[model samples]
Target: MSNLPENSFFESLKAEDLSGVAYKNHLLKKKVLNYFSNFGNSTIQDLSKALNISTPKMGQIILELTENGVVQDYGKVDSSVGRRPNQYGLNASSAFFVGIEVKKEYINLGLTDFKNQLLKFLPHIPYNLDNTEEALDELCKIINQQIDKFNVPKSKIIGIGINLSGRINYKTGYSYSYFNFSENPLSKVFRTKTGFPTFLENDSRAMAFGEFKGGGIVKEEKNVLFINVGYGIGMGIMINGELVYGKSGFSGEIGHIPLFENEIICHCGKKGCLETEASGRALISKFYKKLQEGSQSTLSHRIKSENDLKLNDIINAALNDDVLAIELIDEIGKKLGRGISALLHLYNPELVIIGGSLAKTGDYLFLPIKMAINKYSLSLVSNDSKIVLSELGEKAGALGACQLVRKRLLQSE
Candidate 1:
């Protein structure tokens, strides 16, 4: 594939390599882009007033941007007094982004335009997460294949964001969990392999970004927690309108917190972890063990072995009113509530989003979670938080990945 547009303002924005008047101009152009990104169409007068630039200077930048095909005239703004001014907005086709969500069992890839609209979504590509070079190569290969399917020009595709589970230092582009054998940062390796600027993000945090920016659930709320109850429980924390990435970029590992007294071994090789009792893995384990002990369910005949069972199977069973499935999901929800109660005390988030496959169980899961939160946490603290399911659903991770790429390129002082 061809590389990103050479020596173009888009490339300069990514490189951040300019100085003196050129740098000031670049910053000004970026400010206009950012303004359009955040607030949509704007008149030259509106942009100049909002960005505190003179109308003549703003008009010059807008004209240059229009010539460069980065910004387009979006027609006249609605008005009743005197003449209506022409509005300008981002040219959605001017650039594209690719987002990949890597899971233990499958991968989700999505293509988004400059407008943050998902153009294509390809989910459940059979792939296993592992710590190996071949696995990483396979991932890149799949990414190339999926992007090829979209048929967007290589130069038009600005960057690729890949979301992985486990400890990821996004600033330095290093993943401690997978592909750590290489001396180079994983992001650099991906950039080299895929021939596009590549960024790495933690899956949960990326999902949180997706919700915060595009899920339409958050309007003015600044503090929120996204509970990712997938194969394992993970959390994406937002504080003061920013995603929290602690030292070493491993902040949101809420699953590893030892909140239980159980002897069950977690995937992290620890005992009494929240994941040991409350995650999808834990639910599946409990369900399988119950079946082995002669417990009956509607899915018993359908599932001949534990390996044949899927999270969707349990969700569908609960939706069909299977007693065993409902009971198990409720139990997991209660444990999850106990875990979230601690977060409420600590973060006091304005919203708590329940996400992942188990979240599909809806009220069968949320009702017990609410009950347990009311029972364990202080009323004052828990009352401040509103828990809801993710609006972006299974697509949040991929969509968030695309948004992160945009954020990195467009971030300004």
Candidate 2:
């Protein structure tokens, strides 16, 4: 084993010396760390079998990782063998990750250990996306509060990861779509305020990463499309285990994909975009229109203000068998399905995951989306793909944001 310092991981990335024997050692350690991170607790034999490496090689990797403070011996597994093998798991205290999800109405802050387990989650913090100063202050306060709770050393906190619902340049850490900052860069501002490295990623991409890492999407099935339906619809595409960021990291802007010939202009100033017909905002808007048009429904009696009608409220009404709510969501689901069909034609992904706020509708959302796919998509592509609801629910974005930090900052370091 080399006498390299434990900080070599971070130093190597910053110094750009991740080559030769050091690189190989890094890869081996990362593999071991990833396995333990995924499986929780496992023995050297278990790792060898899982990775198809010889016991001796696996032992060497494990020993090196243990020495580097990346892996820790948890205890012995009670096996009916001569002696129970010692189990190993990631040292969660070794590193920390901070993730923030920026939404229209609020911002969410989360703290996770290197293993991606949630240490703390601060949801629905009052953050007006248009208010730069107030939003920044609120964000900083919540992050500092969480950090204090964890009692982690500043050095252990690798970086802050941010997930937003608009175009973001992950490489430059600049958000061209959401948030307003002049003179000072957002990432630099956050880093200076918090004393940690920072990263910014699109919310959909972050959700896809979360699903890929922990949401039961197998590593071998690398190509996946995650569709997020919230205030608006968006997509995150992963091809060959890498995010399909187009020329400007906006490759998966499926929400703006034209699905209808109608003349409703989208937020992107386009007509007939899928989001104008399928998103939660679209559904709620249409529901209000119908209500005002004297459409008979239980919702009309309950909704005093158009703004009072939330996506979850509509879903609940639909679940309770409200005729108008059910019909409205069913229509939205069908529109979503049509958008997904277009996605199938373009990406031909192995899996299509429906995520975000509307995911709570479950079968009400999925069944109709599936029906639309069956109606619109080609048999070959639809047959090869599986459309499933996200298992992580609303936490996918925050979890994925944390994962972005791990992938970009911690692991590379």
Candidate 3:
């Protein structure tokens, strides 16, 4: 522990041993802990078979985790065998984590247990970039308030995870693309303001982390891609179960990927980026443009203002059989699919998860995206990859943020 870095819990875990035997034992323990943590209580045979390990080895790892207070034995399971197997589960009360998802308009915050359950969810607070100090102060106050409300002890709170929509240096907890304040380092500022260790990550990457930890996608496959479509589009790439943040921590800026050969300007100061043609903003812009041109649609009469055209509005209208909204979403979905097709060719990920606000459109969005992939992507790649909507939905980022802290705690132990 003395040799490990003070700022990282996982570093301490890694510092324990460098030998092959020790490494294998650590991995075995991790596998067992992860299985129980995710699948709830299970018997030794259940875990051994699920993890493809022998009963003796699995028992040894379970014993180690139990010693570390990471796992607890409940009672004996009445099985038709020589003896009843003891049931084991992760200690849900072992620790807690704070998750924060930062958007341009507001910040979503929540407190989660080791099982990633949202013990407390706070209302979204409007974020003002101009008043950085005030914003940070308010954020800290809310976090403290939530912790107090939950009656969680300070020692049990491992760290705070902040998810943002920009390039982030995960190692340094610095966001270069967003939060460009001069005097304060956002991570340090928040940590100082709240007195909690903090971890920062890209919003889409956080979504990926949440989805990965939440389960469903194949575990053996390492390459996974998450496409987040909201006011804008972003992507998170996980290769070998690790986030692929290229040089400068901006690897998954898929929205800025030049797709269309047009002159529509993007928020990133570029023209013809995928977001300009396919994002929620793009859909809203297109809707407004159509309305101005006197296009006949129910939305034209329903939406009095541009801001009134929410992603949910479009989705609901479409679900209610609004021809105009359906048509608009369909067009945007096609563009989004084309963008995803590019990802398929580039990454060849085993699973591609679509998440964010617009994902509520559900089948309306998935169909067009799949169609576009079929049309544009190589047949082999398209055949090998599966595209599905995220199960965590809007809470993915926040949940993933909490998982970050949980992972840090586990790694440190």
Q: Rate the local accuracy (lDDT) of all candidates.
A: 0.90, 0.80, 0.78
Candidate 2 residue-wise lDDT at 180: 54
The order of the candidates by TM-score, greatest first, is 1, 2, 3
Candidate 1 lDDT over 1-413, as tens digits, reads 43789756677766545789988988899899999988999999999999999999999999989988899998987888989899999999999999999988789998999999999889999887888889989998988888788878888899999998889999999998889878999999999889899999999999999999984688889999999988888889999989999888999899999998889999889999999999988888889888989899998997778888877788888999999999999999999999999999999999999987788899989999999999999999998999888888878999999999987888777
Residue 164 accuracy (lDDT) in model 2:
82
Taking the tens digit of each residue's C-alpha lDDT, what string does model 2 give over 385-404? 98999997767888889988
Q: How far is candidate 2 from the true structure (C-alpha RMSD, Å)?
A: 5.0
Question: What alpha-carbon RMSD in Å does predicted model 1 have with respect to the real structure?
Answer: 2.0
| Better model by TM-score: candidate 1 vs candidate 2 | 1
Winning model by lDDT: 1
Q: Looking at candidate 3, what is the lDDT of residue 75?
A: 89
Task: Return the TM-score for candidate 1, rounded to 2 decimals.
Answer: 0.94
Instruction: List the lowest-lDDT window of 10 residues for candidate 3.
Output: 1-10
Model 1, 57: alpha-carbon shift in Å? 2.2
Residue 109's lDDT within candidate 1 is: 91
Off by over 4 Å in 2: 1-68, 73-89, 121-126, 151-155, 215-220, 296-305, 410-413
Each model's backbone clash number: 0, 2, 3
Error of 1 at 101 (Å): 1.1
